[model samples]
Every structure is written in C-alpha cells, then in structure tokens.
Target: MALFGLFRRKPHERLGFELYGAAVRAARQPVFFTELAVPDTLDGRFDLIGLQVALLIRRLHRDPDPRGPGIAQAVFDAMFADMDFNLREMGVGDMSIARRVKNMWEAFHGRAQAYEAPLQSGDGAALAEALARNVWRGALPADAAQPRRLAALALATDTSLAAQPLDALLRGEARFPALEEAPHDRDAGA
Candidate 1:
C-alpha cells in the first residue's frame, strides 16, 4: 500500500498550485485597493483571495467535464495549504494554527455561499448586495459608487470565468477581466 501511494502521482498538484497563484494575483489587483476602497488590512486581503477562490470553485462546479471536480478539490487543497503557511508566517502559534485554519475554512465557505446565488442569478442588485454585506461587511462607503463599481467588476469576472474553456481552467490557465475594463452602469451615468 505504501509503495503504491509513493508511485501514484497527484494528478493536479502542480496545476493546483498554479491556479492558487492565479487567485493570489487576482486578489492583489491594484485597482481593488486604490479605486474600490478595499481596506489594506489582513481581513480585506483574505476576503479578496477568498472571493477569487470561490469564483474558481463555482466555475469548476458548473463545468460538465468529469475532471472538473478533481481539479476543483486540488485547487481547494492548495488554497488551504497556502492559508496555513501564511498563518504560520504571521507568527501564529503551533497550538492555535489548527483552530485558526478551521475558522478560515468556515469563513471561506460562508463567503462562497453568499456569492453563489447572486453570481448564478446574474443580477447586478443581488451581486451588489452580496458584496456589500460580505466584502464591505455592512460598512458600505458613504457614496454608493465604490460598491457599484465593485459589483460591476464582480459581474465582469463572472462572465470572464464562464467564458473560459474547461480545459484551460483545469490546466491552471484561467484569466480574469482587468479591473480597468469592468463596465459601469450606463443608467447611473458614472
């Protein structure tokens, strides 16, 4: 059994790390921090990473290909492993690491659930509401413009993900819409 395990290659391990790297890149977009008013704190960064990861997972779940699920699981494993390493780097004690990781997992799952409905519905209002509640954490900006812009960006991201080929996603070649290209609501005249 041990020999078999050693001989078996984890099919998506490398691709999973690549995908996680992509997610991290998406999370670190400068526009999100400067234009969108996303706080630069740890919580804000985590939320952005969680959002990107959730979107990728959602795309995987909706893919008809049989390999989608396996790739998705590998992506998830990569994400949590990165998170664990990050926590340790931040000086979290060994005894507290497991509990902190569990809490982060719960948070990620909750955010995924919150994002799923709006993303599936393709409704701007619903997407805005979900982002406000979760991303902004009920502390929406004094003006509604930032939230509106973020909602538009989120929709663009959803569309971009939907358009990616399943094979590309599985190969860790997924791409997100650039922030500058996120469409604004014409009706709002902004």
Candidate 2:
C-alpha cells in the first residue's frame, strides 16, 4: 500500500489530468459533428481531441508561468496514455500497440506543426487548407468552405481559451465557447 502511495501523482499532475479531461469534453461537443460535419468516426474523434489539446498546449507554452511547460507536458502524457488505453480496449495486439501509438504520435506532431504557423499568424486560409488536408484526408476540395468553417471555430476556440486566466487554467477549469457566439471577456465565469 505504501509502495502504491509512493507512486501517487503530485497535485499539479492531477490538475493537468483534469484539464485534459475538460479538453476531451470540449472536443466531443456535438457542434463539430452535426454542424461542422466533422466525421464522428474514431479517427475523427481522435483528431478533434488532438486539435483541442494542441490549442491548449499552444496557450500553455505561451504562458508566463514557469509551471506552464510542465503542465502542458503532463496533459500530453495523459492524452497519449488515453490513446494507449483505447487501443488496448479495442483489442489491438500487444506487439502492435507501441508501433501504432508511435504512428499516431507522429501524425499528431505533424498536424500540430502544420497548425502552428497559421494559428500564430492568424492566417485563416492556411489554417483552413491544413484542416481540409488533414481532416478530410483526401485531395483538396474544390470549394474550401467546409474546412473554412472549422478554421473559424478553431480560431474562436483559441480566443476563448486565451481569454481565460492562467490561474483558472492551472486549477483545471476551462470554458469553451458555443458555436455561434464566442469571444467572451476574461472575467466571464467558467
């Protein structure tokens, strides 16, 4: 029992996990599926969750606090841990789990980087193209409207996350906005 206690997570790690959970819930919101037409498949869910987490990581890396980077890392660890668990739950062979997860990590990293510049520069078209290429997973569409909407949502989501205080984020509380009305003020309640 004491040995198990010795392995317990620190308070901050717990907060990291709580924050990750919030991201997961926000990603699962129905607007992405029903309105934005994000496929509700397993891969789609994974991408949405990954995108949400990436946004948080972006904000955390920019955070002034010394603990920000560590919290971002903890959230990342929790995300991959959930992925591994989900793969096992689906009965992926033990021998293949590591390889599959590595592939997922690579994919996620690539997508995250693809999003970084567009997000930083606030280039909606570039972000839309990236989202279309990744989310649609096929040839570029003739009409870019589909992914354009998603890009708008992503930008709005980022704005909402940015409005929240670092202290609120450190405490594992986040308030993602509604699909239509976003951009609330900083003092808004979670």
Candidate 3:
C-alpha cells in the first residue's frame, strides 16, 4: 500500500538508460587525442554541431597512425573516385562529375571550418550540441521506411568519413551557381 511504490517508474527508466548506454558502448574506441580533436585547420566556418559529430565519428573510426602521410587526402581521393563512378553510371560525365565532386569536398571543408571558428572563440558545449543537431538533420534517410537500410546507416554513419552520396552532399548547398542538367537533344522525325 505504499504510494512511492505505486509511482515508481525507476525500473523502466533504468532499462531505457541501459539500452542507450549499450549503444554508446558499441560506438566507443580509442584514438590519439590530437587526431580525434577537431583540427585547427577548420579555422571557423562550418556548422559546429556537424563538425563535432564529424570529429566524434573520426575519433571512433579513423586510425591515429596511417601507413602513409596525407592519409586523409588519400582516403578522400578514394571516396570521391567511388562517387565519380556512381555519378557516371547515373549519366553524369567524367568532367562534370569531377568538377562537382571537388566543389562538394571544398564545401564540406568550409562547413567544417565555419563550425570550428565559433568553438575556438568560446562556445564549447553549445557548439557541440548545435553540431549534433545538424548531424541529426543530415542523418535523416531520404526514405524512412527502409528500416534495414536505416539501421545500417545508423551503424555505418557512426564510423564513416565518406561523404554522403554525391546527390545529397553536392547538388547545391555546398556549391555555387548550382548544377543544371543539360537538355537532351531531340532527333528529327525518324
């Protein structure tokens, strides 16, 4: 007959907390402090929340020591190459795809920098939260009903450094003038 006992939701709350704890546990990894830390190279231009998430993912997934120098650049080159091929299969030409991909990478870099600037100027946790918000926004799947694909994205995204598929990552927000498709040529009556 205890009122306290009747009101107790502690068990349910605890279970919920533990579930989240396990998820974070699954994401955990060790990496160099400097490597995991947001690079000074950002120089303050991108979204803070997104950059923090990027750093968090980088810390969890990237190796502190790579086989060669410029490992980041090499990784980016391979990612863009894959993106280029995908674009080509979708009917974009090699030159157009290359240009668009390069522009998108630059935009990503710039966005990182924008977020970093405010962080260095004294916004810390606020900046991290903002970046987290942006990350969540970016994480929304174009099609939400694909649960299997969504779960894979949740897992893959937590450790991924690859830019999103070009269609999402590029096609404007991160670039100038925007990409316009060329009109198809019509043949004279057969």
Candidate 4:
C-alpha cells in the first residue's frame, strides 16, 4: 500500500481552497484601503484577510449540515498553507518559518474570537471598537470613524454571507457584500 496516494485531498478540501480564494479576493478590495482608510501595510492586508476568512468560518459553523466543521477545518488548513508559501516567497528562513506562522495563527484566531461576541450581540459599537483595536494595532487613529466603517463592512459581510445558500457556500461560491451599497439593499433582490 502506498503511504502517500495521488489526489489525496477530499472534495471538501478542494472546495475549501476555492473558498479561501474567494475570501482573499474579497479582502483585497481597494475600497478597504482607499476609502475605509485601512493601512496598506502587509499586516493591514493580513488583518483584512483574517476578517474575511473568519466570517466564512463563522458561516460554515452555523450550518445545520454535519460537514460544516470539516469544511471549516479545510479552509483553515488552506489559509496556513498559503501563508507558509508567502513567507517562503519573502525569503524567510526555513528554521523560523514555522514559528512565524504559529504567531500569525494565534493572531488570527484571537481576532476572530474577539469579533464574535459583538457580532452575536448585534452591538455595532462594540464591534467597531474591536476593529479599531485589531486593525489599528494599538495606535488608535485620530479618526474614530475609520474603524467604524470597517465594522460596518464586517457587519454587512455577516449579513451577506448569512443570506447566501449553504449549498452555494459548499460549492465555494461565498460572496461578500458589494462595496458600493449596503448589504440589505444589495440582497433585497434575493
């Protein structure tokens, strides 16, 4: 028996990789940096990506389907794999890459957990404050409105993802809200 077989990834893993791609694209929207004033640094980019992925994971976990948790795990695995590749591309030493990736994983998990409470309670202000702390990285901006806008985006994403069909999500068709309009207005046709 072969210890490692060809095409080993289960179907959910492939769907997860595709879903991660969708999250990355959603996170890369220029409006986040230009209009919302999210810092354009690498850390800023990662923060946005984390937020988007966390939303997807949240949606997956809420599903009644039993495969939801497994799919979420696959999405997370795909994320770390991409991050490892990025680190390698940046010329990080092999000896330290694992450590750095671990740190990033912790940060992502921490922020995701922190954001969930406010989202569950439907407290926009709490969510905005959480965003300010994480996105701003402790140097709170003079313009409080920026983080609030980010929080709005996050909330809109939650609503948008919730509205998406579970089957669509399973097919890796998760769609973020349009930057040009509120989520409720955009999903009104659905």
Among all candidates shown, the one with the greatest lDDT: 4
- Model 2, which residues run further than 4 Å from truth? 1-11, 139-143, 182-190
Ranking by TM-score: 1, 4, 2, 3
**Model 4 misplaced regions, further than 4 Å:** 5-7, 141-143, 183-190
The true-structure Cα RMSD of candidate 1 reads 2.4
7-69, model 3: which lDDT tens digit per residue? 875322432233223322322322211222222222221222223233332322334444212
Q: Estimate each model's TM-score.
A: 0.91, 0.87, 0.33, 0.90
For model 1, residues 1-190, the per-residue Cα lDDT tens digits are 8889997868788888898799889889988889888888888899889888888888777788888888888888999999899999999999999999999999999988877877777766766776777777889842376767777777788778889998787667989777777888443222
lDDT of 4 at 151: 72
133 Cα displacement, candidate 2 (Å): 0.7
Ranking by lDDT: 4, 1, 2, 3
For model 3, the local distance difference test gives 0.34
| Number of colliding residue pairs in each model | 0, 0, 13, 0
Across 1-190, the per-residue lDDT of candidate 4 in tens digits comes to: 4657664776588888999999999999998888777889989999999999999999889888898888888889899999999999999999999999999999999999999987777666777777888888856652366676677678888888888988898878999875665433123221
How does each model score on lDDT? 0.81, 0.80, 0.34, 0.83
Answer with 2 or 4, whichever has the higher lDDT.
4
Please list all clashing residue pairs in model 2, or write none if there are none: none
Question: Of the candidates numbered 2 and 3, which has the greater TM-score value?
Answer: 2
What lDDT score is found at residue 64 in candidate 2? 84
